[model samples]
Target chain A: MTNQSSWFETAVADLVDPQDQRVWSIIVSLFGDMAQEPGAQISGGALTQIIEPMGIKPEAIRVALHRLRKDGWIESDRIGRVSRHVLSEFGRTQSAAVTPRIYARDSAPVEHWHLLIAEDGTGTQVLEDVMLSDDYIPIGRNIAMRAGAAPLQAEGLLALDISPQTAPKWIQDRLCPPELRASCRALLTAVQNAAKTHPEEWTPTPLQSATLRTLLVHRWRRVVLRQPDLPAAFYPPDWVGPACRNSIIRMLDLLPRPSAAILSGSG
Target chain B: MTNQSSWFETAVADLVDPQDQRVWSIIVSLFGDMAQEPGAQISGGALTQIIEPMGIKPEAIRVALHRLRKDGWIESDRIGRVSRHVLSEFGRTQSAAVTPRIYARDSAPVEHWHLLIAEDGTGTQVLEDVMLSDDYIPIGRNIAMRAGAAPLQAEGLLALDISPQTAPKWIQDRLCPPELRASCRALLTAVQNAAKTHPEEWTPTPLQSATLRTLLVHRWRRVVLRQPDLPAAFYPPDWVGPACRNSIIRMLDLLPRPSAAILSGSG
Candidate 1:
């Protein structure tokens, strides 16, 4: 029990945000990773127990829940003095949209890509509108690219099927900026250190498992969702995106998700 | 003999430039069409006979020849008081460079093409330097295209193997501008009218054939050399490039090239 407790504390410390932590965003990531299914709910006590290890106060969690509820991202019900929270339909839809990208394993590299070029001045708006989707990556003010063959019709734009042979440093840096690279490298180290501290003889309690999983998914969600999935040619030489993903997957496998009934039980 | 003389007079009148005639350019065209081969020379008398029918004066021809000599495009030699002119090595090289595009019949459409894109501001010069070659067509300030696979190396530029599927009006207009389209349309009309005047009963003298071939090649060279040979999609709907090429080819077939020896002989 002492070994498990020490390991859990060390893992939580390694994963917590050293910068300003947005409690509302952490809650969204927690629910998205844990209780995303229909009719699944987390009691207010369980939410606090899972999040308090990350150094968030109970009042902060309450305020964030209020904000999330007002913003239509969460809903709550009170039954016999016990409050329970569930993801709203709007929240589930938004989470579902990004869930695949956030949790996706190393997928096959996208084989085909096409470019959309707008006219220099006035046509930029047309391409800008199309770039609102996550699929499009802006190469320049008037140029955007997407994976797959060119559409049969791209109005007011010049569409070309492109096989990107090489890219310059500016392009690689633009796709994976300095801040993103730093975050990915930091997370990789954190996950690697946490994995090494796990003692094989000790298994975590349901609440402990839930707490570790929340921290792992919360930090990783921020990193993985900020960058697009591009071919290896587009990444800088020192980019650790693949290594970061491997460490993250390995850590998540070690900390299996705990069921909601056991997590909410009053021990 | 009377019928042939009348037909030659009408042909010269139909082919003379209504706009300002660049005499030096016309001389270049004349040599490129009739005496581009090594050791081939046109006597002074033959030059006068072939060019005078186009309404240029002998004094104007002499001045143009002097300018061409100063420009290193022509060399003059006097053998037993008979002056002769031949293309210099520099002039022949320049003429041979564009000869294929000037005289090409309907060729197979280029199936492969690539685009070179420069970074927005500073990289434009790199693409501009590449655009100096006739093979590249500048699509925009930062974009140039060529009809072949991408080079193995393009320093400081993004190289993409592109299959251009659809282009907007601005791209088409940039490739084949209004003036080029108008010139092609006008040449098409002229060639169609000239082809109708062929009389089966009459055969032209060598001087007549050389004069007609020079005028045809001169006008067509001014039109064809100014535009790159792009795929049909790059041209506007009103572009007469294919029709103009066909008409010019039919006219050239009707007027066979005269040998330099026969052309220089005094009738």
Candidate 2:
């Protein structure tokens, strides 16, 4: 048990974001990963047990919860002497929107792609409006592309059905910038190290499982959601996106999600 | 014979360029249409006979010949006290390059087209360089397209093999601007009028055939060469490009090319 505890500490340390760690954002990630269902709620004690061990203070978690409640991302209720929190309706909608991308294991390469080109000065606003959807990626200031045929509402732009033939270094670099590549590589290494350093015959308690799942999903969400699912040709030579995705999926499968009842009870 | 002469005079007046009449450009058209072969020459008398009837003075023809000779478009030789002019080597090469486009009766619509997109700021120069070729049409400052698969030397741009599915009004307008559409319509009307006004039993002399052929080819060249052979969808609604091409072809068939020997001898 002591060995397993030590491994769990090490894994928590490995997954905590080294950059700016806003407690509210972390709480959002936690709720999005664990309690995203309509009525699913996490007790205040279970949230602390899952988050406080990541070097975050209990007071910081309380403040983040207050902020989330005020912003309508979370709702809190008191059951006698204990408190429980659940995602608000708006929050659940937002979480459900990106859940597919976060949990996608393997996406087939998109074959049919189209380009939307706007006129230089006046048509930029139309392209910008279209690019607000996640389906499109901006190729240039006036050009946006998507992995489908042209839409029927393409009134003010020139839309063409395109098959990508050759992607140059500039575009590859633009799509998968160096920082994204580095983030993917770092997450890949972190997950691999976490997997490798596990103690033999180790089993995590319900709280420990919830903690690891939240951390892994949080860090992986930050990486996966930052990039669109471009074809392999658009990725730079050193981009490890696919490998990182595989490692993340492997790690998530290893740490199956714990029920909210078990997590709150253990705490 | 007098009636034929009056008809010929009226035809010449109708065919004269309402815009600038640079005699050098007209001569280029004449040589390109009638005497493009190596060692084929037009005697100075024949040139005068073809050009002087268009209200241009003999001295203006002399000055234009001097300019053509200085610009390396025509080389002159003294043949038994009569001057003869043939296309210079450089001029013949330049004229030969555009002959296929000018004389093409019908071009099979290009099915395969590709786009080359450049990075926003710095890659504009690369796209501009590629746009210097006649094969490409500029869609924007950073985008150029051609009617084929991606080339082997696509160094600095993103190349896409595109099947154009829709072209908006702006693109159609850009490809066939208002001025070009007006020119096409005007030439179509002119040719139809010329074809309508021909009297019965009109057999043009060799010199008259050369003159009428020169006028028709020259006028059509100005219109056809200004626009690339884009797909039919790219042309504006009122663009008469195909109809104008058919009229020009029909007129040329009616006025068969006269032999150089007969033309010069008639002069």
Off by over 4 Å in 2: A132-135, A264-267, B132-135, B264-267
Instruction: Please write out the lDDT profile of model 1 over residues B3-41, one tens digit for every residue.
Output: 768877877777766665788888898899889998888
lDDT of 1 by residue, A1-267 (tens): 587799899989998877758999999988898889987788898998888989999999999999999999999988887888999999999989899987878855564789888888888888988888547888777888888888877887888887676777767777888888888899888988888888887688777888888887888888888876776667788888788888887878877787878544433
DockQ for each model: 0.69, 0.76
Query: TM-score of model 1, chain A?
Result: 0.94
iRMS, all models: 1.4, 1.3
After superposition, the stretches of candidate 1 with alpha carbons farther than 4 Å from their true spots are A133-135, A263-267, B132-135, B265-267
lDDT of 2 by residue, A1-40 (tens): 5888999999989888778678898888888888888788
TM-score of each: 0.95, 0.95
Model 1 interface RMSD over true interface Cα atoms: 1.4
